[model samples]
Target: MSSSTELTEKKVFLLKSLDGVIFEVEESVAVQLEVIRELIEGDCARPFISLYNVTSEILALVIEYCKHHAETCSGGTSATIADEDLKTFDNEFMNVDENILLELCSAADYLDIKSLFELTCRTLASLIKDRTIIEVRKMFNVENDFSVVEEKAVRKEFAWAFK
Candidate 1:
């Protein structure tokens, strides 16, 4: 095979968010974004992949996640690390309050990082699943955009929860 073909075969892409944040990710991981990978494999000459819809902050988080996973896969560290350490890292990484978590979920989804997207979604779901409506609203900073009557209607809809 030609060198360019080999390079393309081994090479991955780094995508930049609209706000100019860059993320270096492996081709294997980037391929998870099927459309982008198809374009890349088809020899689209775009130097930098642009994610127009994603913000820099969210992109940064996605980069962090992809970088970590890439490192793990590349054998940077032995797999001998204790489960506790892994759990601690996850906990610390997700320690941010609800709004940031929601943003991370959105970013993960946009980046097509299925595991991270699921992790964030599951975490958010778990957090709100057992909480009262008032608590959920406070956690998400969701203003009571509903009219008084609308609010009452919703409360009535979930009357079984109150009981």
Candidate 2:
């Protein structure tokens, strides 16, 4: 059951992504996006807030995440996502391709969603942690940019990292 405050605060905001797609989100969800929270607070979001940096696909995912978090944190049961636990939902949410995960991380940073940013960063760290330099370079498809001597110097400078 929703509290009287929750029921009374039924204002909806429209968020327009870079792809020209718009999403309607409730106040609860909107506050979670720190980048737009000022607009909501100042009543500037009466018109749709344009997210110039985030694409529609990523924006949708952010909204979904915020909604789920809001529902769960408010002690309200969310019937969405099969009523999955947040940890399970977060695991599934981060199961996208590496490219998509990078995009999501970038979007989360741009949108200033702290939880989403941390989750994405943690997921990415897990993937890269304990991997060798060559393996990581291969994973990111990054060609070696350093000459042999420069590489040796840098490796020697951070010798502990090489170990």
Candidate 3:
């Protein structure tokens, strides 16, 4: 095997999102999706894969996250510097709108990208933890199924949680 090949010469895979947008990702980026890794290991990974559950917007974000992580982890830098860079990148990546954030979370889960899934979940947990029940519901766009009286009673029952 020739180790002299440049990074740009690496093999790439095509991923098609539900919205029919096609994205070309290098093998390093594609392997970050555990589902794709499994298919690759089993020799079943096609040159092009279709993801029916992910929209183009979400898929693009997920690919970006994976590509960044891959490059940072494999880059010629000290471990401390790479870790710090990734930390900063992840913090900034989670700054999208709530709807897009949730979509990215779901897409990450669907793609079996554990790191991205965990990041999104942690960010959401932090956001929800500091907000009131109404605020949390609004953030998630959850329709209130409980009447005001029911909500008040429940909150009174679990006053410590509300606090």
Superposing all C-alpha atoms, what RMSD in Å does each candidate have to the true structure? 4.5, 4.8, 2.5
Ordered list by lDDT, greatest first = 2, 3, 1
lDDT of 1 by residue, 1-163 (tens): 6687776676757788888887776676676564376677886726878888788887776666655655565655556663444556566778776888998887777667776777799889988887987898887777779999998899898789788
Worst 10 residues of 2 by lDDT: 75-84
Candidate 3, 46-128: lDDT as tens digits = 76788999999889899889999999999989999999999999999999998898999889888999999999999988878
For each candidate in the order shown, give its overall lDDT on alpha carbons. Answer: 0.73, 0.89, 0.88
Candidate 3, position 151, lDDT: 82
How many residue pairs in model 2 have overlapping backbones? Answer: 0
Error of 2 at 120 (Å): 0.8
Off by over 4 Å in 1: 1-12, 32-35, 74-89, 138-158
lDDT of 3: 0.88
- State residue 54's C-alpha deviation in candidate 1, in Å: 1.6
lDDT of 1: 0.73
Query: Which candidate do you rate higher for lDDT, 1 or 2?
Result: 2
